[model samples]
Target: MALIRKIIKTSSNEHYPFSVPVIENLKELDLEQDIIIFSGENGSGKSTLLEIIALKLNLVRISLDINYSDPEFSDLKAAINAFTVEFSLKPNGFFFRSEDFISYLRYLNKTKVEAEKELKRIETEYREKSAYSKILASMPHKRTLNELDNLYQRNLEEQSHGESYLDFFKSRLRPKNLYLLDEAEVPLSFQNQLTLMVLIKNAVAEGCQFIISTHSPVLMAFPGACIYDFNQEVIKEINYEDIEAVNQLRNFLNDRDRYFKYLFD
Candidate 1:
């Protein structure tokens, strides 16, 4: 499993100053483990850094087949173009951002609606232009329409957001790739986070590398993961137990009554 050895922020003087200040001061990030977890609070630049790395590595965003561009990406692209990357190997993988998951769900619904509309049009055309309809339909292979219709019939939008998100991810993730995830715990429950942990474990076992930025104690607790704390705007490796998310959970669980008393008092 070849990893991204190093990422150094070369030139900081760019058009758009990084919204997250932590990113501007980042001199280098060393990837020493197969599973790297970036743990940080809001505005800590975890996602910002992950996006730059993912784009530099050319990782595709899962569930987004269409070329949908965001104006924010252009700025990031320009910034990442200035960074120096050292990769142990040319990696291939998908970048999963929490925001993209939301957009993907909307895309799924939109696609389903469009497919239904197309189906209706085909039906109407078949009635009016029977001979020509058969030609047009056959040109696409009768199976093409049926296959798309079948997909719409079992549309992922029918499931819960978490379930559909998992389904979409499962459908995209493949073996032997570098998966960069930013705040992946966004749409998942505690149980689903555990499920994702299992999936990541299996993927790593099968030669996949994962670099995730998250605030979930469950995700940060991934077995043998290299956890980088962004609490002070420095990406420094730390023990899992030292992670704020993990410690907060530990403190609350250690004395639930005390936590409640502190909160109420």
Candidate 2:
């Protein structure tokens, strides 16, 4: 598959004229990897960087902020508005922050409204044609239609937060596009994070590119991923075993009794 080849950033320092400037250092980074992981502590500008890249690439950006209608949403909306005004880019992304799940459920409910409208339309047509044909012939496909409606309702009922997150990805992501995901592991467990990694690999193989900001050790462990550590202020190629979280986890697991004895004893 054809890769991004390069992402040149005009300013690595935030002090540049633009809040986030254009890409300038394309020669320094590799663009052929299946996944790119951004690791950082809170307030490390990881999300900001991802947003800037999303604007530049005209890709859909998904993050935990998509579900909320609070001050964060307003701030993000302002940034998106500013970015769109500054750059001629179309709105192709969906924001699914934690609070945004309610909005998604509302959207799914619209399918029920649409299905009802279709049922009404079909009933009217059937009644209108009943006079010209056998009543049996104009009985209409109500059973199948009702079954579909029930199926959609069941889906809405079964939409756990994780499932909803996955649903959004499955429905909104298209081939040959860019995806900026911030802490996508928020709704996924360790096992699900691994599943998501596989999906990301498959997507990358199919010509989709992703820039993800996350703290999940499982996600950070994606094979052949490029990791940037905001805490260290360095972009280095490292395996998951080298990540602080993984090392911490390993240390605790290796000497659980010793570590627990300090508190318990």
Candidate 3:
């Protein structure tokens, strides 16, 4: 392994993540593939396990402005210390949580709005002042706008939510790092999810590794990626076709009217 080699739980305290059945099980997981995925339904422990791993690795969150030290994460912070992770190399990466994306988007838009308001105020207040004074007064707001523009060169808010999500991911994406993502496909449409898969494939080709926790069957279809089914009683690696999401999707497509009838009745 070029990065983390394994993860082991050294203590037996029934803490938050530890209290979860699948996470509480004693074990070590060896890293073999560059792309690892955790697949399961909600509360099946996929997202929680990924979060603990991200904490162990000390990776930055993809959606910025989150305070990890907040009281809400206190239990997870303590729980992570019980695990000992073996590393072949200190890995670099970001932990992306879908739930945080919208908040991040709002932050960006809010900053831009504030800057615009300041610039407008400066223009009105400095109308009768010397050109140099006006320029100096407006410099800070202009600089803020410039830095925001450099982020994506387009107004993210102007795009559809799905478009903005992809743009944000692309802007933050870098090579030769690991990415831990939880349900990144939430905002994407069926077609956009495939686009995201292509992006992941290209990044992996450039030495990036990913450990994603997702319910999307399209993501689970990544070729040669190692997938663990959290839906199982124990954490177990499984094939694509055998994944519950994949099977359920296939069933729905095969008998769409049948499903609608059952739901309606």
Instruction: Return the lDDT, model 3, position 97.
Output: 92
What ranges in model 3 sit over 4 Å off?
A: 64-72, 125-137
Residues 87-135 of candidate 2 have per-residue lDDT tens digits of: 2223244433344455656665665566567666666767757554534
Which has the higher TM-score value, candidate number 2 or candidate number 3? 3
Worst 10 residues of 3 by lDDT: 1-10
Best by TM-score: 3
Candidate 3 lDDT over residue span 48-139, tens digit each: 87877888989998666667687547888888878887876778889989888888889888999999999999999999999999999999
Q: Each model's C-alpha lDDT?
A: 0.76, 0.58, 0.84
The residue ranges of model 1 lying beyond 4 angstroms of the native Cα positions read 14-19, 62-73, 128-132, 135-154
Q: Distance from true position, residue 108, model 2, in Å?
A: 3.4
**Best lDDT goes to which candidate?**
3
Ranking by TM-score: 3, 1, 2
Q: Candidate 2 — number of clashing residue pairs?
A: 16
Model 2 Cα displacement at 83 (Å)? Answer: 11
- TM-score of candidate 3 relative to the true fold: 0.90
Candidate 1, 48-84: lDDT as tens digits = 7887887788878654653437666667877887787
